[model samples]
Target chain A: MLYTVLPLEEVLEGIEQEPGPTVQLTLGGITVEAEPLGNFQARVVRVLSTDPRHFLEPHCQPGFLIHGQIV
Target chain B: MFEQPEAEQLPEREAPGLQTIKELGQTVTPGGPLAEEMPFHCLTIIGQIEGHLVLPPRNKTTKYEHVIPQLVAIEQNPKIKGLLVVLNTVGGDIEAGLAIAEMLKTMTTPVVSLVLGGGHSIGAPIAVAADHSLISETATMTIHPIRLSGLVIGVPQTYEYLDKMQERVIRFIVQHSRIPEETLREMMFRTGELVRDVGTVLVGSEAVRAGLIDEVGGVGTALNRLSQLVAQREGGMH
Candidate 1:
């Protein structure tokens, strides 16, 4: 898979309007929909693709929540 | 050659000739003093990588202007069997490092990288650019989102530019190394790893487990692997 680093703010701005593409991400069976948040520094990796039960797994929990502001 | 005058009466003008003779005796061929004894393969070390127009710590980092030529030379040179890169850097100019990494990725010669101390920031992409990668047991690597150091305008265009640059780095890393993009992104934006920041630090074994590095070995292992790769490539050619 191709990976790219993008500013959180740009992603957030995109998310503020409409949910773009379905970002399929998996952390040990916990599939998440990487939706863009209005805030540029944050993106909501909401659990969309997996059942709520998957979240109970130790590795499937919210892996990391990064916080930062657009510069 | 002019004969020297008596020691005490020698003219000062003769000093230059005498000095030239001494220099001639000391000077060796451009190949260097131990060129024959030492191997012809090149192992360039770039210590400092200050950005833009500025030169860094070792007086200079690997500038694309210089590095591109060197890579071409290495490719053409029959003596250079393989390339071993040792990185301990905080990352530098994005374009410069990317250019160097691109060359390394495409080079015919086997390339190996060893992270001696720390390979953080853009250095992450560079460390994985090689054909094979290794890290010392004590070395550390950091995965973080792109950060612009100097004054940055908060305009939409600026944000877009930064995003594009970030994508390039991520794409390169994911393509070259075994690490997955989403996993890397989690690490990049992972909170609590860096106080008041979104990044994670992985030690030697951790880096290996994360798939950022192939093995946890130092220079010796790195060299051995490089040599083996070269031999394999040569055998394949035949």
Candidate 2:
């Protein structure tokens, strides 16, 4: 996948793509393929990596979902 | 024979078992009596910090969900004069670690962190999140680059995303600690420090020398420092 786990701020301020078959958002310095998971929330499916495990171990997979409502 | 029975004469509402249970709970968890009016609140960050995902039952984890609400409550509670963050973790989710660190950074109550055993990886940021940080003489810290363990798409953008996340951690550590960005980066990217990894391991005074930790001390020092901060804050208010 080519998705990145975006912070809540990035998701709220993400640049929306033009109307298309799939949702996309440019955030956290990368263009991510987004799927609406909830209200004001999305699941990024583009950036996938095993880097997050370095912090913890075993189960620290990179997250793609970003959820937060903008004020 | 004299007056009423001694046990009956005691308060009707209080139970003796309550004290035993409270003591047992305190022994199990770091925070003593959460409801009790105390001068400082203890927040212990142990095991892996489970962020958005849930870890296996065998793996001990600290859920950010729980910590976040406790932080909010600690901030809102007027009785909590200060916060004592005790860290003995190997790090966990980066975002979750950063989230906890950020909340501590912005909290109005004074926070003091004490690194007991090992504060590695993401735990580094949290250890330095407090106004004053302490690391035990035998404690060690590992500084390394952000790594991925699962399936990874080999592409330029992937590395870019990783670099951005790494920068966030570096920036936060540099801003809060006395270590310069260059020195911290060097420690992070240094090789041969670990048997099979590309990073540096600082033990005890080394962390203090590297400017990552404020002092080389333990619980006594951390508590004393927190007391001073709480007193200063209270004094300022007066």
CA error at residue B188 for candidate 2, angstroms: 0.6
Model 1, B4: alpha-carbon shift in Å? 18
Return the lDDT, model 2, position B69: 62
Query: How would you encode candidate 2's per-residue C-alpha lDDT over B137-224 as one tens digit per residue?
Result: 9998889888754467999998998889899999999999999999999988898878877888889999999999999998889999
The reply for model 1, stretches above 4 Å from the true place, is: A1-71, B1-33, B37-47, B55-60
Quote the lDDT for A1 in model 1: 12
The 0-to-1 C-alpha lDDT of every candidate, in the order given, reads 0.65, 0.73
Query: Which residue pairs collide in model 2, if any?
Result: A1-A46, A2-A46, A2-A47, A3-A46, A3-A47, A50-B148, A50-B149, A50-B150, A51-B147, A51-B148
- TM-score winner: 2
lDDT per residue (tens digit) for residues B47-92 in model 1: 4443354432223344444455566666666677888888876566
| Per-residue lDDT of model 2, residues A1-71, tens digit only | 11122222332232243322346554433444555655555654333222321222111112345554312
True contacts kept of 2: 0.00
Candidate 2 lDDT score at position B172: 95
User: RMSD in angstroms, candidate 1?
Assistant: 21.6
CAPRI-wise, candidate 1 is: incorrect
lDDT of 2: 0.73
